[model samples]
Target: MALRLDRRRLVMGGGLGLAALALPGGAALAKTLLSASGFTHGVASGEPGPDSLLLWSRYVPAGEADETRLDAEIALDPDFRQVAARGVVRTGAYRDWTVKITLDGLEPGQTYWYRFIGPDGSRSQTGRARTLPVGRAERFRIGLFSCSNLPMGWFNAYAHAAARDDVDLWLHVGDYVYEYGIGSYAADDRIAERVVLPAHDHEMVALADYRLRFACYRADPDLQALHAAAPMVCVWDDHESTNDSWEGGAQNHQPATEGDWSTRRAAAVQAYLEWMPISEEPWKSYPIGDLATLYRTESRLIGRTRQADIGAAYREGTEAALTAFRDGVWQDASATMLGSTQEAWLARELRANARTTAWQVVGMGTIMGRTVMPGDALDLLRPDLSEGAVRSFANAARAGRIGLPMWMDRWDGYPAARSRFLKAAQAADADLVMLSGDSHNAWAFSLSEDGRPAGVEFAGQAVTSNGMEKQLGVAPSVAARSFVAANPEMAWAQPSGRGYMMIDITPERVGGEWIFMETVKARTSAVAGAHRMTVEKGRRRFTA
Candidate 1:
């Protein structure tokens, strides 16, 4: 059902500011100057379909009242000369004054402008959104983003992508907001003018804390511009809850100090749903004409098994025991990343979408390709490490003997799970294109199963999070060259760039362009580097 709206002209008294205060009897009683806090977070639209889109905004009442009725309108013109859809949504303190309404009955492949009006007649900034193209669409462009840590640097990637005219949809894989408190993760020297709000000074654990943290993140102008530019499809990763989170617990979350893991996880999910302009579904798939079907998967806090603890293994057992443990328990077949239900669903979708569409795109968190660090990679870094680092290097080299990957936090930890997904894609003969993030580095991998090409992956870099270069204490080019040389599956890598990925899909080919920002420490959207790669239709391999 469409939203009901009062057709009466809202009383306009003062311009812009809150003009009047209404009485209990639906009468204007007094006049008061109101701040523009009602639309402080701005408006966004998402979950686009051929005939529908969801609208969202955060409203703050002028007075002490906990609830307010706001009006929303969809129009064909910027001035709202031809109002297509009009409705009223009630927002209360329960949802932090956030209002989301799904507007349906719209034409396919059409653009629309929308805005929200507060009770006091304060209008929000106009936002533009469009529905998905129907039937044989010739082309579609998608902007991919992830790991937008506010304190680390400016959101130049968001700002850069918002200026593009070709993007039809934007996908944020995960880590939209960092849960770390002030002076954590990001160095103080690296933090420029951007500072988180006072209310979000501490790490987010409770519902209120998470809510405030999102509010702080959404307040950024660059991030807001990206939201208003195009329809967004978002998924939350570890930072939205806690770092390296699984189904039962997280790395950063301690049950004794942060309360129950379930409670904290629930709070984080709720806050993310309320803030993001997306549907309540944990995962969804979008069909772009006959060209592609985009599948958004949940890899964390859904069905993921406990990750391997190499640190614990080293501390508790001898090096020989650690090797045995890595060779045995670490490769447990029962361990899963997407669990059984989601895994089955993805397989079914791959087969179905492959038969119907030209491309099957898996939108997910973390890299899907195997990236085991070369055993000799440590040799190149020995000169850079301090005297105290010798022990750390020895431990890492010991683990490397048993063929452990660089980062257990990613798909490298779940080799069996990855194989299962790959096998399904291979069985379906799907031209799978995996779009991923969470490594904070740009990567392109030629993935295969059973010695046959199954798919290709384009993992985008972070918006502002520090990448391997920071941790390795090496130059950006050095890290990139080292990884690319070490792994045959990784065709290319940019281990230090902070930016987004631009994906263009056509019937004949799918192309990915890595747009590296000049410096995340500044506000400019200058380009530092860019690399493009393409895969031919049905080949499931990158073309030179």
Candidate 2:
């Protein structure tokens, strides 16, 4: 049976009683009890295909601890008067009361409203989902987002995007939910209003911890609204598990204190799958009709090796040591960003997509373009910066003096892997468009391999994390100009901003507009500013 009221009206009318849980402060207590019963964390949809998509929701009976069943339905309208599909799904504590149902046999290029119904007739907030077009897609816009640390501030970027009707899908490259505890990585001034749940005030390391963290993030109204607005394609970066995570361990994880790395990694992955509206596949591709082929690649846990220690090289205080590290460790041909198997699959996919599509877009976790900090840029560092941040900059500056890129965690550190990927694109003669997030700053890079233009990259800024402006003493404009001047491949840079990227794909070109929020410190979606850049088809670079 359909709920008589509209979904938006239901939420605005406080039918679900989540307004207090969505706010800050005392809401933390409500969040903690949310999982005990009822439909918690609004509905979401993802893993969209031409004829199918995955629906997700979390529900628990008030007095039941065992598995419970819920009825799922889809319709052409919010009122469900035109009911199109229906199914039943089971959820229990084993899966954290989260339910995911993959509904197939649906029409292509259509929008559907979906909701879950409890046994007692309670309904989940309606969620909107879309299926990929089968052919001749004139245009598709993806709202690109990442690095959303809740305690940092309001999710203004998400709120802004949720208010838009143009975005066809949401692509969160990584760091959807940070693993940090309260105050560990949040803005000091915003802690009172953006507090992490006290029960989860330590870095997440266990299954329960990760589940609680996801619950906390999902309780936010802005995030839930975004999920409800459209289907999302998401992947996890390091922070979803821990900071700077790789195949074996993470920079922030201490085996001595955090238990086994594999155990923690397993818990993180399990919680992610249960909470997110994604498939079990580590990587996958989406075909947007004949206009574009979007490949979501995995770059973390599956096959990434440990990041090279650039700081250690710099600490050696000798050009010889730095050169040795750069030549031997940093450029190790066998070290991979994406494991060998995924690399081969990506290459094959790129070639196949190029044969039929106008664009081959790769969405990954980190920036792919080379970003060597100019030695002179160090002069802009803020004196009040933490010692660790200063040291990191110093090392990067030292490497820059020798023409080495900083941030070994990025593609720059795995030079051979990057070269191989670029060569694959060049060999396929593909019109490549790379989308990335991880760095808190906005960037546009003209990618090249051996002086031959290979692709163009539009890396989005963080939704709320502090960017270079927080660490640098100079103004944002000066820092951006300095960065652009320092890196040849860099076409543009926004050193300071809290925003998301809007990527518009057409047969002729792909355009990206970075939309910055006026303030994350406040709960507002007023636009601060925006910058647009585009690459023409077959250009292999951003248009000048």
TM-scores vs. true structure, each candidate: 0.89, 0.94
Per-residue lDDT of candidate 1, residues 391-410 (tens digit): 56556656655667766778
Clashes of each: 0, 0
lDDT of candidate model 1 versus the reference: 0.80
Which regions of candidate 1 fall more than 4 Å away from where they truly are? 1-36, 185-189, 198-201, 316-319, 380-398, 472-475
> Could you tell me the lDDT of residue 5 within candidate 1?
11
Provide the overall lDDT of each model, using Cα atoms, as 2-decimal numbers: 0.80, 0.85
lDDT of 1 at 278: 87
Candidate 2: list runs displaced more than 4 Å.
1-35, 186-189, 198-201, 386-388
Candidate 2 local lDDT, 180-274, one digit each (tens) = 87646534634444555433346898998888778768877788889999999997899999999999999999999889999999999999999
Q: Which stretch of 10 consecutive residues in model 2 shows the poorest summed lDDT?
A: 1-10
